[model samples]
Target: MPEQTQDDTGRDRDDDGRARNARPRDRFGRPLPFGSAGVPRIPEDLDLPPAETLDYAQRLLDEGLAFNAHEVLEAAWKNGPFAEKSLWQGLAQFAVGLTHIQRGNAKGARTLLKRASDRLSAYGTAPYGIDSPGLVDRAHTLLMALEQGKPISDTDLRARLTISH
Candidate 1:
């Protein structure tokens, strides 16, 4: 038989007396129940090269997997020290906004898309070149439609640029 200790509340304690084997606390010191702490951290060894990261983002976008593309690009954007960091960050935001649009959340999409457009516009053609300008324009167009309470028209959008979905 195992020996037990007694807590201040007269509860029988386990060998370690580790708060009665309760779940770990969060940053705010609130108890987080077991298995509810959310996703695990990404390993440092899993980091991809810049070119491969960008390729992953493009592939996901081309496959009509906007959410996955956003995740990939966002990770790259955050980790990158590229000369075109602002451009990539804006693109990542645009991808996330598009994901929201696909999910029918017009307001949320508008907010994120507007931020992307603004960031890209600030970079302008000087540092980000023509590509940033084009992305900003696309984001602006989408934001306008969303602000007007109009559904994004696939035909109209497709006419301007070729997005996978």
Candidate 2:
């Protein structure tokens, strides 16, 4: 047998030798074959303003791309202000819950939704115009539907991150 090429970490690396997943991913963020064309990726370093982050994430959700939305929210959570970390993290969890539902992982969906609800609840009032109470209610509704064995459609799962003025 021929010797296999190996790296110290055995992980994919960027041209500069930084670790990164260079694989293309589907709209759901599942990895595709190396040569297959796939959905564009959300940048890991994306650090948009709060309103822009919410808007971009909301658009992704509307497109039934919850996984990508989660990435955007995760980036915001990681790169945003400390005071708003919980809020962004909660939004990321909410998106991931939807992503789990899309991927047919009922248990994961339930767990993530519950966690998102708890975090959103701590806000008490809307922060950055985010409808935290509505999101908490939405999470509870989705959990109830899941428990009842109801099917959640992609359209039904799309969430509005902010209150409409």
- Which lDDT tens digits does candidate 1 get at residues 1-165? 234567889665666664342344332223466666723322222356666765666666565556566666667667777776786687778877877777778888888899888877886663312356666677888888888888785433321112222
- Taking all chains together, each candidate's TM-score versus the true structure is 0.59, 0.90
Please identify model 1 stretches exceeding 4 Å from their true place.
1-46, 82-84, 126-130, 153-165
Q: Residue pairs in steric clash, candidate 2?
A: none
For model 2, give the 10-residue run with minimal summed lDDT: 1-10
In terms of TM-score, the best-performing candidate is: 2
Query: Compared to the true structure, candidate 1 yields what TM-score?
Result: 0.59
lDDT of 2 by residue, 1-165 (tens): 122243587767655566677679988888898788999988766889988999999999989999999999999999988988888899999999999899988899999999999998985675789999888989999999899989998767968899989
Kindly give the number of clashing pairs for every candidate.
0, 0
| Candidate 1 residue pairs in clash (backbone atoms < 3 Å) | none
**True lDDT of residue 90, candidate 2:** 91
All models, RMSD in angstroms: 10.9, 4.6
Model 1 steric clash total: 0
Most accurate candidate by lDDT: 2
